[model samples]
Structures are given as structure tokens and as C-alpha cells.
Target: MAEGISSDYAVIELWKAVKSIKKDAQDVSVIEGNIPKVAEMVMEYILKNINYFVPINNNLVRPKTYPIDNDPMSVNWLFVLHTLNFSLWYPKGTKQWKVDGKKGYFGLCNAIRRAIEDGKPIWNPEYYTKMTKSELECILQSDDGEPEIPLIDERLRILHEVGEVLLQKYKGTFMECLKLSEYDADKLMKLLSMNSSHIGTK
Candidate 1:
């Protein structure tokens, strides 16, 4: 992500980092078949569904139940969701956390949807500023029961930070920020990355 490095070069560096970290971190044989299959499927999927850049479609991105037709509100909802989109790893041996039969990040999506459905003020920055642990717990409840999303405290802090920033600088809507970026992907990525450092810390 350094300045002057083309995306191709950044990808190469990322692959190198992955190779180095995974080399000693696990038994290579354990992931030998899995990694290749995963990579092949990812490549195939991307090639099959490649798309031209378009303005984000909030309806498509979020669960159907929490539809917010108002463009600014929809954008605010997406911003809230993205604020929690980091470090979803669970304990090594536990059942993978799931919601509505979806695992990993998809599961997280449903969990957020359910939280909103259950009336969590998911799109409101002022609500997040006063959110409590119990309230967050309610938001992260698993569909299968007895499991919870990891990093509740950290996620809560991030939520608050993102919400507060949206309120203060963008009139509580990330759509304003998006407009400031003129709908440019690079500008938006930089904006998000800069905000990431301040996540959960205001």
C-alpha cells in the first residue's frame, strides 16, 4: 500500500507475505489441496462474475429485510456494516460461527441484519455512542445458539468511532463522503484506510 507502488506490485508483495507467513505457521501438507482448490474457485468465480464499476447498490449489498430506500440512509447502513468488517477469526477448534446457514463473513452479514431487524439502531451514530456491551451482544447472537461473534469490545468501539465520525463530518451519512470522493474507488479506499487507524478510538 506504499505510495508509487502499482496495484500489481502490491499484489506481488502481498503474495510474498502470505507465502512467508504460511510457510512456518502451519503444516504445509494440511493446506496443500485446500489452498489450490480455494484459489481456483475464487479465480473462476471472479472471472465468471466480473463486472463493470458502478455506484454501490445498497439493496444488493445488504440483507433484504433491512431495506432502506432512502439513498443516504442506505449508505449509512452500509457504512455501519463495514465498520465491523475486520478480524472475524474464531477460535481454532470451535464450530465456525454461522447465521441463517451461512458461515464466516456471510454469517456476519446475517447477524447484522438480524440485529437491525431486532431494532438495534444499526444505522444511527448517536445510538452507537451510548451502546452497551449487552446491546452489542444482542446484535451478535448466533442463529444456532451458544456461539457469539468474536471481539465484541473492539467491534463496539469501532462502531462508535465510525458512527461518531459520520455524524460529525458527513451529517451522519457516508453518502456525503462518497460524494466528496466523486465516486472514485481509489479515493474511497484511501479514505476508509485512513479512518481505520482511528476506529474505536474516536
Candidate 2:
């Protein structure tokens, strides 16, 4: 970023370059191959140079979620990893943790909202990549140590708690609705037989 330039401008310029190249590239794999180079540029301009104002958690404005390191590959490789992870959620067989919680940030946002709205019970833990609180703290804790990878278990636990809080508010009503909607074919058949006096006597 320039001394006086804004993050929005920096991101726009970066995306223009990234998209132009991506438009002609064969596949995301090719983009993946070049990620390190893009990552280097992002580091140089955004992470290392860091002068502009960057915001987090703003709902009113469009989020420009470039990595804090400004590593374009942070954004790039992230997309590839997230897409692959989410695809694993709908399983063909056993839903091992590998794909069970593989939702992107938006997906997690929706899941949390649904859990809250539907009065669903505790959120089932899945991997929350960006919201890895422990990992973030570990990164802060280190001065020279390698950045700590997040504990997937702890992350899931947090989601479960959050889900529980949301669901508790409406759990009774939601469960009642669930029970009422459940089918009882035999009981329905018995009632129908008893009420069929005028039905097809011929």
C-alpha cells in the first residue's frame, strides 16, 4: 500500500491483477502452483508494509478479508483448502472429522444462525479455520516460535457451546414442532377405518 493509499484500493488493485491472471489460467491448480509468488507479493505490500487501516467484523461494508500478512496466497490457498473441505461434509459413507466440520466462514455463519433460530441443541463441532481462538492466542504468545496450528477439538467445543445458547431459547417449541410433524401411519389408518362408514359400500 502507498503511504496515503487505502486498504480497499490496495485490495482492488491486487484482485484486478489476480483475476486477470486467473481468467487466462487453466485451473485453480495452476493458481495454486503460483500461490507462493502471490503470497510473496502480498507479504511485501500488505503484511510487511502495513500502513493503511484494516477493519474486522464490519457488517455494513463489504468485507475485504485479505490476510493480515497481505499474503495473496493466504487468500488463494485458503480458497482451495476451504472448497475441498466443504465438499467433504456430505459423505458417501462414514462422516469422519476430516470433512464433517469443513465449512467455510460463511457456512459457519449460517449454521450458527440456524442453530439459534431453530432452537437446535448444542452445535456439533466442525473445524473453524479462521475462528481458531487458541491458535490466534498462540500466535500472539510467540515472539520467535512457529505459529501454532489451532486445536480442532477446542474450536468445536466452542461452537457447541454457542449453539447450545442459541438453541436453548427455543428448544421446547422446536422439539414440539418436530414431535407433531412425526408420522404415525398405523394410527392414521385406524382412524380412517373408523370414519369410513360412507365410503365406497359398493
Candidate 3:
């Protein structure tokens, strides 16, 4: 996979960004630096508190019966899907505000799972890269009388970008980026953030 874009380049660029900030702006400095001991201490603290790092929970948006089920690619695809999951609120005074009693993020998750059941290629990046608005609308369809989710075009764009990046840089699996992180929580966060946007600096 050497022919693919080097993730090392991203790490190096992040370091450069970290160094360019003013001394007074020490947010990234607290997270990264040449101080090995401080870095080790941070990692140890994360390890000690790993149980609290869980993002998924009973109250979160997820498939009821475990849709992915040992499929790493599907799990990664879920992460990619969530990267752009937002703005699901309906207009004020709308009578229909839910998709089969699931509203907002949960409603979105329900619709996506239903699409997968209906044979949409939810786990295939190639399919999403060229997904059409009509197709997306179909997949995102709400229950009858319910308001549709907002930002259809932005969702499609995010899906396209995620598909392109995964195929080009991570060999069609977000786990590749995870592997590159080598079990370090900070590096994993940085790698994932590189795909989205930078924080603290901008």
C-alpha cells in the first residue's frame, strides 16, 4: 500500500501545525510535543479511563439487532456515516416530526438501517461515491407524513468524500487508519480528525 498516500505525511503536517501556533495558544502543545514523559502520562491516563471512552450506548443511535455483526468494514462505514450525521431537526410547527416514533439522530439511523435491509449498498464506498439525490432521498425517506431529513446534498457530499478518502488512502477500510494509530488513543483521534477538520488551530 506504499503507492497509496502516506499517512505519515498527515502526522508530519499535524506536527507542523502544532509548532506554528503562538506560545499563548497552547492547546495542541498540551496534547503533543517533544516531551516523551508527558505524552506517556497522557496515554496512561487514557488507558486507565478507557471504559469511559465508549461512544455507543443504549441511548445512542444504533441498529437494534446489531446490523454489522462482526463485519469490520460495516462498522467503519458506520463511523463514516456518523462523521456527517447532523442537522436532523424539522421545521418548527411541523405536525410530523418523527420517523416511526424515532426522531432526529435515531430517526436517521433507523432510515439508514432500513435502506440496508432494502438492499442499498450501505457498506460499499464505490456505490456511495456516485450516489444520486433521488437514490439518497429514497434511502432517507421518512415515515408517511413525517418531515424529511435536512441537508440531503451535504450528506451526499460527505458520503462521497468519505468513500473517496477510504478507497484512496485507507484501502477501502477505515480500520487501516486505526491500524496506523498503533493503539494510541491520541494518534487515532488525530488520524480520524485529519479526515474531518482541525480543532484548536482554527
Against the true structure, what is each candidate's TM-score? 0.63, 0.22, 0.62
Q: Which of candidates 1 and 2 is the stronger one according to lDDT?
A: 1
How would you encode candidate 3's per-residue C-alpha lDDT over 1-202 as one tens digit per residue?
1212223454466667657764557454464455798779999997887776444453353456345557655666576457646766644345433555766665666776777778887767788878998888788877874456677887887888777888888888777777899868899888888866622222
Backbone clashes in candidate 2 total: 0
Candidate 2 lDDT over residue span 1-202, tens digit each = 2222223445577789888877876655364688899888887887654545244333333223323345422422232223222221222232222111323333333333343345432222122223355532332222223222224454434434433332443242222222333546575455434434423332
Question: Which 10-residue window in model 2 sums to the lowest lDDT?
Answer: 91-100
Q: Point to the candidate with the largest TM-score.
A: 1
What candidate 1 gets wrong by more than 4 Å, as runs, is 1-72, 197-202
What's the CA RMSD for each of the models? 10.1, 23.6, 11.9
TM-score of model 1 relative to the true fold? 0.63
- In candidate 3, which residue ranges exceed 4 Å CA deviation? 1-69, 95-97, 197-202
What lDDT does model 3 reach?
A: 0.67
Which candidate model has the greater TM-score, 1 or 2?
Answer: 1
How would the candidate models be sorted by lDDT, starting from the highest? 1, 3, 2
